[model samples]
Target: MTTPPFAPVTDADLAVLSEQLGRPVRGVVGVAARCVCGNPTVVATSPRLPDGSPFPTFYYLTHPAATAAMSVLEADHVMRELSDELASDEEVAAQYARAHEAYLRDRAGFGDVEEIAGISAGGMPTRVKCLHALAGHALAAGPGVNPIGDRALAMSTWSPERCACAQPGGAG
Candidate 1:
């Protein structure tokens, strides 16, 4: 099982994440992805929260702009289009399956939760339920790892290469 690369979390990172989420962040393991400006874009969360609840989503999207872009895409029914593509395209479907496996493997590195076992976020291995989850996984694992995620990122208005963070040093 290959472990997904994650940056060490810091107090400043938690501060930025709290600012982005508009609440105190919890169960965060590390910063999975960050904007070019050094602010976090995606965070790696524990499978089980401090409250002992089973959490399925390992890679969580935190960047407000990226989240908004994914929301717009979902509102425009991009999920249906992507689902259709998944159903019709065998190669893409296979790639998506591999992505689901990769997601599970990565999450297993953190810990195993029986509740979320064999379950990957974004309706992976079958459907495109949530672009936010897909995009978050793509950003965390990097390009070519999640084809659907890469596609969603391509279709979205947000770009990780660009700094859209409202916090310090993000404007450019």
Candidate 2:
């Protein structure tokens, strides 16, 4: 399995993340994906946070524009369409299952959290849910790894190739 590419987190990155999230980030292992402007788009968080909380959503989407676009897609009920596609298409289901395994493998690199041992974010391997998490995985894992995430990114108005970050050049 190909491990996802991520850069080591810096204090500057943490500040930018705090600004983007409107709160300080906890247990962020690395910057999973970046915007065209070099701002963090997705963050690879630890399975367990500093507060002893078991956080299962490892690939957390932090870019405001990307997150907003995903929220719009969810509001439009695009999830149902994707869910139907998953239900009807055998290839999609297979790909989604693989995506789930990939997610588990990626998270296992960090310490294991028993509370979320087998769980992956976004209702993976079964149903479509939370485009944000799926898109995060897509951005971090790169194209062709997560079909549903790729589809969600394709459908969304946001594009990683273009800079939509509020803070240009990842200014904190």
Candidate 3:
């Protein structure tokens, strides 16, 4: 049986994402370009939050094939490179604990513990989980504060149709 091909994000979808971000997307560029493997990467920069401050934020969306390839490549890279260091069960548990704690603390400003637990406990969907893992690796390799792997960015996807960032209405 043939597996259905993944759908690519279209220019119209990119335009929608740019619109939701409230800025003219600067086209595929830089780290966004790297993550998308040269696929068209849409970027909206310095988006403001009503009251202006240097938002210092960007939104990146890639073609679906590139997105999928990135996921696989990142996973393979981690497995081959970090497997020895992460081999022990104790080490794996410790890493999970650290990552989970970081996730909780980073999200704590939002509200109650129960709500936060509920949200995270729901289990991230497969694609999102992979992207989040990849983002973590990307950040660890970078300099400075390395904010790229945070839950907000990690949870984003190239599927503009399903992306809240690409669509209007409701706070995500």
Give the candidate number with the greatest lDDT.
1
For candidate 1, list the clashing residue pairs, or say none.
none
Per-model TM-score versus the true fold: 0.96, 0.95, 0.31
Writing each residue's lDDT as its tens digit, candidate 2 over 11-109 gives: 888888998899999999999999877888999999999999999999999999999999999999999999999999999999999999999999988
Best by TM-score: 1
Q: Candidate 3, which ten residues in sequence have the lowest lDDT sum?
A: 118-127
* lDDT tens readout by residue for model 1, 43-139: 9999999999999899999999999999999999999999999999999999999999998999999899999999989999898899999999999
Model 1, stretches more than 4 Å misplaced?
none
Per lDDT, what order, best first? 1, 2, 3
Candidate 2: pairs in clash:
none
Root-mean-square deviation per candidate = 1.1, 1.9, 14.5
What are the clash counts of all predictions, listed in order? Answer: 0, 0, 0
Evaluate candidate 3 by giving its C-alpha RMSD to the native, one decimal. Answer: 14.5
* Candidate lDDT (C-alpha), each: 0.92, 0.91, 0.35
